[model samples]
Target: MATAYRQTHDHPKEYFVETDTDTEDSDFDDFVCSDSGKSLDATIFADLEQLFQSQGSEKNDQPGKLLCEVQTEENIAEIFAEIRKEYKPTEAEWRVSNIDERKDHEAASLLDDAFESVSSEVEKSGSIEGCSSCAESVNVLDVSQFKKGQHISMPGKFGTIYQHHAIVCDVKSTSGTKAELELIHFENKDKSIRIRKGIKTYDLKNKQIYLKHYKKQRYDCQLIVSRAETILEDFKMSKFKKYNFLLLNCEHFATWCVNGEEECFQVQGALQMMVDTLTSALGIGSRVVKVVQQLVIMSTDEIAKTISSAIVPEIVLGATAGVYLLYCLAKTAYLKMAYKKNNLCLTCLKITLKEMWLGFLVFSSTSVVQLLIYTFAVPAIGSGVGIPLVVLSVLLSVALKMSVNTFLRVLRNPFGKEKTKLSRPSQLSIADIVAFSYYRLEHVAIVTDILDVNERAQTARVRCIHYGLPKLLAKRQIVEEEFEMNLVNSSWHKFDVDDTTSYACEKRLSRARERVGEKRWSKTNRSDNFCHWAVVPIARWDNYAFEEVNDKEKKNKSVEPFFNKYPGYIAEELRLGDVVDYKETGVLVRKQSKVDQGKNVVEIDLIITSFWKGERKTYTIDLKRDDIHVMYYKPALCISMQDRVERALYWEGRRNRLLWTTNGFIESCILKEEYLDN
Candidate 1:
């Protein structure tokens, strides 16, 4: 009877290395058989030969070579074992090393021992085992342990080899010892931040494969699972944004996964460093200033010894250092204030450092020029003349250096274009009307024809027009009633109609006072008498326009009649007439005014003449106001309004109309016929 043999293990086709072999006449007749008194079949040997030939052809193009020599049955078994070992699966395991466990031993030595022991076990048993030692224990984390929505983080390197946090995602594993891990990390690429997901494979026994679980102390596992689902959903749709290392980065993302809030410890550290640096710099500056002052006083006695003496050099050095120190202090303060106002992060620190370095470079250049001027020119002249000349030279050198830098900067761009600081109120230009709304004043007319933007005060100078029917009517009634009462008492009461009209006007004035109330008049008087003109500190401007007001009408107001026209008549004429034109040559006014009482205050009288058939009549309106508020309106608002007006004129054959509501809102009704009624 012939004994039979069969292959025990199945190897993948790709792992088999095929080669050509001429085995048509090969036979295994002399090979040893099992000790059970059975002889192997000849057909079994033929099948083995064909298997080699088929595998050889699959791996290699040649047809007469073998991958390995198979002279004996034992050699064939060894080849199959080698193939099975090569295709064995790997797995991932992790363990936490506590400080107490490794207190008596070195961490590096412990890690080396763990790696060596794991290698020996894998070589002998063909599988990794968990360690029992307290210092080097290993816990194998199975694929089932990590759910789809579980959040895990690992330490990794980002830009310039700086350590950052990376999130683990899309974990996979098979029954074999191997496990696959996909890591998602943020990288600053091409001047922007991007999410990069990468896959890696690890063996269970590999000491380098360590994972840490990120759990929130406040939340339970159920809540964590719920939040994780939402976070993972958001992560899938998240896109790359501009990288701000101190504002948003990988560490922030990882923290956000566990907790709802995003934060980075590295950025906090950087900000703390910036604060310390600024505090130290300011302290050093103060000390230097005091020391320099002492040095200057001490060197005054030795100044006349020689022009090349150490005293003159000390003074020069002290002065230059003092100025540079002052500049640094000021620059640092300005940057800190700006960053705080904008709520920016540690990026401003880097910018502040760069600006300080540039300032130092300029200071050094100025010093060099001063030294050259003193050395070359001071010695040629007498000490009496050279002393003043050297001092002048130092000052002039610094000034010239600064002037040249400014000139170069202006030449480089000429326009001095810069990103506008959004925190600061923008400047308003001439012919811009802003609605002044604050306190008791609601939506008052604040016309800025001769506008002045005071950046220091954060305010603007505006010519305010105050219109009140009750107040104007009261003033006119008082004058006309007194005139009529004088005529009635004296013998000058001419006619019955005139006496009756005067009496009616007096009764109307009394009724108006009673109806409008004395408090309103008293408030209006306080505003007109004491707080007529004001310098208002502005936060910002709301709506703005470049509607042109007739300059001639404003200037000629003082010469026209006062208190002769009714308030209603004046309001109607202003609404109907072309007092506010939307077409004029505009100017960017940058003048600043002093906050003085009764300064830049003007009362204007507007006169409108109308002719119907053969009849001619004139109407006069006196405009005066107190408690005027002003603010800088953004120039962009003016440009936008100007464009809208031009478009409305081209399409609708009319100008943009402005209507002020009683509630203090200025409505720009562009090409709308209905709003003209307001």
Candidate 2:
């Protein structure tokens, strides 16, 4: 048997030689015999001898064995050529061996000089030139430079091109040329349904490496180091999961490694695209279904056959034209409803038209491409499959076009003008008596203050007193008993005031009125079945009633002059039946009654006459009082009193006695003729 000896070196070589062990030989003779092992047999030794000889001048010998020389480039090339002809290796295997060697050698040469220069500069400056951390230098390309706890990035190819990141846990190098890295990375698969920690080993030459620098300070370095070993162990015991490209991808993992936050910009962008696509698809789907339904309902047997026999180009053109017409009709109907709902002005209508035009332009362009696909490509594939395919293409085309239009709409202004102003028939102000006109409650109220105004809705919030027993509580015996008065005699009451509550109450009242066969109430007009409160500026009456004149001669005038100078005179101390009438002077007053007495009332300034519940009535009021109370008496009950008061006012020619009308009330107590002349 021949003995084989292998030389121990950085690059090892094997040699075989035959020796006679039966004959004893001296050490020097054995060495000489080993030297001549290359010349033993020409055929068997030719290739092996050449391989050893080309290795270099270095030699090693063992007793009764041949010595082998170091390998060199020329001999290795010859051996590689011979091996290539006889035994062919697969591309993967060839890359694993030969390609890896070449890559490692090239990488080492390129990075060695750069690393040395960076190191010298860092040593002098105490930091890398552009990087705060020496380990995160931008020049890092060789995997040999990867240290434990360092974040590294790898460029991805094929399905994922977003680049992946990992943390280096371990690094090993052979002969300072080839490097191996063990890395740990976090990955989420199946749209974040499964989370996985993974560990992988990679040859330096097979992957491109970069030192990943954090944009912000990384404070979790120690935590990363502590968890790395546990993560790697867990990864080795776990099964692989499917990967998602958008929701849970490689970019998400890399960001997590660097900053402990899981985020991916690519995933965010893709999700937004999906949302827009879905919105467009839903819109198109609804329209397409409606169109198909209409077509099915209207189609005749003859029409179906005619459609089937039509050429592909003609069919495509007709379909495109039909879709555009459908869109135009839909848009016109939508615009009509919107115009009625919003009552848009001419400027707003123009703006809406421009927006529609932009959408139409985008749709036209997409339809052209869809027409081509349907005419040329889809027809060749047979109508059975092509019909559904064409429908799907139309859906996608509409979706894409609408998405672009929506994106552009958001980027620019969709509404090019300010909102249109509302036309309101009523004006809200302080101290205006406003009834809940349409609710049929017949509840009289006095406006204390206007709380809020919604100009867009043409509504206002006026704080008021409901004045009588609420319609809800009118039939309840407890309400009458608690106040010790009839439902009609109840004093001021408070009610909640807001748009929603008022609207709900109005709706309920409408249903009740409809069931009762009552006429529908109008907001603009007053009805005998309903009490419509008028806006009365009673402050203007108070100002006109008590006008004080600064006269030099009458500086100290007192109560005695009122009997001589004016027609009306009534005192708080006087009885109700006292003889005091001033009809000729166009001024009339009455004694201050007990009902006008309150802590808020300092004095009764004036008695203003106004129509209440379709009857004329006099109310004693103080200018300082914040709220006034009025009662709603039915027309039948107050008809006699109203007729008497109307006859008296007419005979006295007090036609402008601060009378209140349905829409609004006159503030001045002066007669209409005198007021208009002034």
Candidate 3:
């Protein structure tokens, strides 16, 4: 059996070796020198002796002090040369076994050099308080002292990386007086990094490592140190990247409870006291000011840490978390600006859906690979054994995964009755999917509806054939691959003109003319219902005439007729209450048109209206296009027939009507002569 040997000091400059064999002529004789008949060990005894003695339980015994006192520049050169001599023509087994040791030595040397440089610079700058209860202008860091590198990995659990550079910068007391500042340059570009200053003062008389940290105005360094030490009581190794216990705020409910209105009052008083203390120390007018200042400083370092910590997390979460936060902020800002100008929430769900689908495709594949590795390779390597546990492991893993998914789903929608949840890469809501479907279907419907009626119209045909169908088809084709084909088919063509009872009657009996491929239009034409006579009524008598004239070019031109007046109508200056037949309708003139159009004079007619008085109603005012009141032109006022038609159709559909039509005509009832004066 291989036996563990105690670290022992032998020849100070020579290597130390230990053997478990009772007799000298054992297999370990290979380590023995053939000529001297003595074992040639590979390690130095003096170096180990000094290290073990310095770290021993004794007053005034520190690793750095002992190392510095024993190992000088000459000593380091000799030790390194000796190590190289022993390792030369390196044995394969020794090389493999001592890789970590060699790395540690190399890293220590580099760190020592770096600290020496730092010490030289500090000596030139100012003197620092030493551990001897003496103020000395000495280089704090000696090259031969430190035997380890600051660059280290945080042990246990998460594969987090950390590097710490601390060599006791300054000591502080209960009084807010700090001796020196220790700064570590963390590689981070994020502006939100937080910085926290630690105290490094040692009590030489007490031989204790004194800690100093602030709490409000009065620095409660002792309290912080005591609490931290208490938490890490059992941890012997108090070093960076070591697995040591730490105190955490486990009272989440307490915070929430104090934030309430009733408890907030009590908290406010306590906060006031804390604030007052900080205000005095920071020399700020209010508690808020002091807090903000401290927070700003703290955040400098914290943000850097956060940036560093997030570097690996970004790999797992992808750029989505960061990008999403920025996107939301930007969108919110834009929405606010646009809201001030009266804009709508026009975020296209179609674009969002497309991106989600693509993202899902990539994420799903990655998740499968991750699942396989975690389930198979990870366990095998970590356990250092292989067995026929694949079937049982897979089932257990899948079941646990499925349970987790179910829990998440239940959390999201508590009221839902669904069970046996399976996780999807793209967590799209039913609402989102429906909205996307509706948007696509509406566009398709518009194209199909147009093709149903006005397929021959060049603009309509071109729009459906060239632009509309191509865009709709592209979306359709992509979506079909994503979703089921039956769902798309049914959603796009919701209304059935087939055996559907009432709608079937509405459908044309005779075969509709099929203009496009498989796309047909209604052969049965409905009543024109144009109301041309009512819309642009012909005037029985010409009352007023005017024309737009260019000031730059003076030319004689015939002015247009007012109130749909016929050219053959004898031009006459009409007065109030004059009866005039215009096309199919009779108009009672209450007032004449405005008698001004550039250089040419025009007349106005006031038609009769219900607003007119009994006897005086006979005289109506009819306004011409030139005599119309000029006001601000709003783009919103330009509502097309399509919008009105849609609203009418919506209302009609709510009433369950097969078909509904609107007469596009606006009646401006006014007596002909009513516009004379008033």
> What lDDT does the true structure give each of the candidates?
0.33, 0.36, 0.25
lDDT of 1 by residue, 98-132 (tens): 12223212322322232333233333432211110
The best-first sequence of candidates by TM-score reads 1, 2, 3
In candidate 2, which residue ranges exceed 4 Å CA deviation? 1-150, 153-165, 170-179, 186-205, 208-213, 220-223, 227-257, 263-277, 291-678
Instruction: Kindly list the per-residue Cα lDDT of model 2 for residues 323-352, writing each as its tens digit.
Output: 655665675676555343222223334545
Q: Please identify which of the two predictions, 1 or 3, would achieve the higher lDDT against the true structure.
A: 1
Q: Candidate 1 versus the native: TM-score?
A: 0.21
lDDT per residue (tens digit) for residues 104-159 in model 3: 35433533442343333433432211111110121111112111111111111222
Cα misplacement distance, residue 325 of candidate 3 (Å): 4.6
Q: Native-vs-model 1 lDDT? A: 0.33
Error of 2 at 157 (Å): 11
- Which model is ahead, 2 or 3, in terms of TM-score? 2
TM-score, every prediction: 0.21, 0.21, 0.14
Off by over 4 Å in 3: 1-443, 446-515, 518-678
Against the hidden true structure, what lDDT does model 3 obtain? 0.25
